[model samples]
Target: MDRIGLTTVVFRNRFASTKPKNQVLEDELTLLSTPEYFVDRFKVHNVEMWTPHFESTSKNYLKELKRSLKKERCKLINLQSEGKFDPSDPLEENRLKAVIEVKNWVDVAKSLQCEAVRVKSMKKSYSKAVLSLNEITKYAKAKGITILIENHSDLFSDYKNHTNIIKDVPLNNIGLLADFGNYSSNPVMFDSLKHIAPFTRLVSAKTKDFSNQMEHIPYDFQKCIGIFEASGYQGIYSCEQWGKANPNYDYEKITDWMIDNIKESI
Candidate 1:
């Protein structure tokens, strides 16, 4: 249960987005049909988990997601939304919608029994970052849910920037979803992981096949595990892979290696 788990997206190429719900379901079945050797090896907690596509253009999205969670027999660890929240946007209409949608997402998370929801760390000034998190933290605390920020967009570009946001909120319920194998473009994956490790409520061991990449290489996952341990991070490290190349990447096997590394580093 302490080891990392792969997101459903890893096993399938076509099931990339929200559409074709049946395809997504099919992918889940295919992933579970085997012996799940990796699951046991890595000490994976569960076979099923999802990051509900909350940004789709479809109505009744939340309801569909609720049904999907049950049908898929998976826990929703993260709810990915599209709208950006900005505190310094003097536009009252924009700010109003941002607050309302956050409130609604809280309600949805409660109904779905989801433990965490993903929020974007907006590209705002340092002071604005704190102000923005303050508003988001109030809503999270009220709903009894945790807000985890992904290094999506500009927010994951720097940990120091996010730390400012963290200082402003200063709440247990608001934390980071430490991501790995990402922010490559920004060139600070390891640094970001360490910076967010202490506040991380959930962790993501994001993997990639960079054998063909010109600049960045595939993450030194084992070393990254050491970093997580050094920071005293004990949260789940979800494997969310990108692209079509299937490494047949075994989560259980990798997790076995990573956890062992964690133990050694400490």
Candidate 2:
């Protein structure tokens, strides 16, 4: 059975605020859930973190987090690093800065004992993005963590962009994090998933509106799982849900439904 996991983005509403690019500002009333919260609430053994939900990446913070995860017998599977870093920035100085920022997150991921750290692709220029990721991969490889490129932004949604980088780089440490719904509800989502499935190390099993009868409304969960199955992807299908999208639905119920659906499929 594929391991089920939860991403921190599922509880976006619980965060303190979304100002200055949706990064958690770490203030009172934030209601940000801790690693233990997910372990206790959902009973999941695997966790994927989106950077925004975290209050800090200091050594002490990460050390405590790792201890908490171990205490609960939960594994930190992947870290979605700050999305603001763009390795393809046209400005030479900015691109260098982006590398440093992502490198720092790589170190952070290492501290947390995460298996992989996902970085956003630079949409403007593939060559430059490859160059940037190559450097980042070297750093991540040294730290014993895989570097993942997700199908997030428009360029990454194409799938070929992801394959192109994977081919050009030719390093085992580089892989893809496939997200089912990031292509704006495109019809070819499954095909795109098939194309990139071979290179996928983890999946962002994104979910949206559900029916009153507790069925997934926005995407075909079974067919997507079939694709993953055929591709031999035996890995984490991290539940990446947005609770606020359907305010009327009980967020906890919806989350449980998503996890159950994936568990049944796998």
Candidate 3:
């Protein structure tokens, strides 16, 4: 149970102050105050921070965030380091630029004392993604931070391609961040989860919808957990409720349901 955590993305609606005007929700929560929310609301100390919640990667901002986490007795276990740049771009200059951006996030993760950071491969070329990840992993290794490649968007949505990218990276610090709901279909999603479970360092327990009774309806959520446990995965299952685009849903109920389900499944 201590391994359970929640991603800030589940509360995207409450982060109006940091999000863009079009994306803002009804409430607000700065990254500095998120730790307290996690502690008080969830009764958990582990946090998986979404990159967008960060006001800035500046040293002073990171120092303040660290202090806040310490004050709340919370641990930032993972940083979901998202960006627009394509790390696997064929163009050398473009790829290097993306590499630099990810490296900067690695520096941020180090400053926050996060155990791992999640990144993505946006292009189809595994070789190119490998090149970019190698550089990023080398940089992260020195900081004692692990680099995670999630099954997110574009080429990585396919399990074979995603695992190949990790296999090709050839670095110990590089691993998979298995996401439960990133695939195109139910069969593919479960198959991919099974294949990547052994390599997973963290999990994005993504839930899209729930029943009135709080049951996960998209797929067999318990079966998903069973697969990872069968594969010997014993890491943080960061709860993420990626419901429909609408903000009218009950986020608190959805999050509570997810946490309870994950606890029961594990």
Q: Pick the candidate with the highest TM-score.
A: 3
**Which regions of candidate 3 are displaced past 4 Å?**
17-25
CA shift at 212, candidate 1, in angstroms?
Answer: 8.8
Q: Summarize candidate 3's per-residue lDDT along 1-266 as a digit string, tens digits.
A: 58798889988778863444677356677889888988888887888888888888888999999999999988888888877788989888888888888898899999999998888557656778888888899999999999988888677888887788667888899888888887889998888888888888888888988776766778987788889999989898888877666545788887787788888988
TM-score of each: 0.68, 0.89, 0.94
Candidate 2 collision pairs: none
lDDT of candidate 3 at residue 19, scale 0 to 100: 44
Better of 1 and 2 by TM-score: 2
**Clash count, one per candidate:** 2, 0, 0
lDDT of 2 by residue, 146-256 (tens): 999988765788878878889887788999999888775557787799999998889888877778898777779767877998889988888887433454666578778
* lDDT of each candidate versus the true structure: 0.57, 0.78, 0.84
**Pairs that collide, model 3:** none
Against the correct fold, how does model 3 do in TM-score? 0.94
lDDT of 1 by residue, 27-104 (tens): 333322321433433444333243333334234755565665555455556554445655434565666566566666
The true-versus-predicted C-alpha distance at residue 219 of model 1, in Å, is 2.6
Pick the lDDT winner: 3
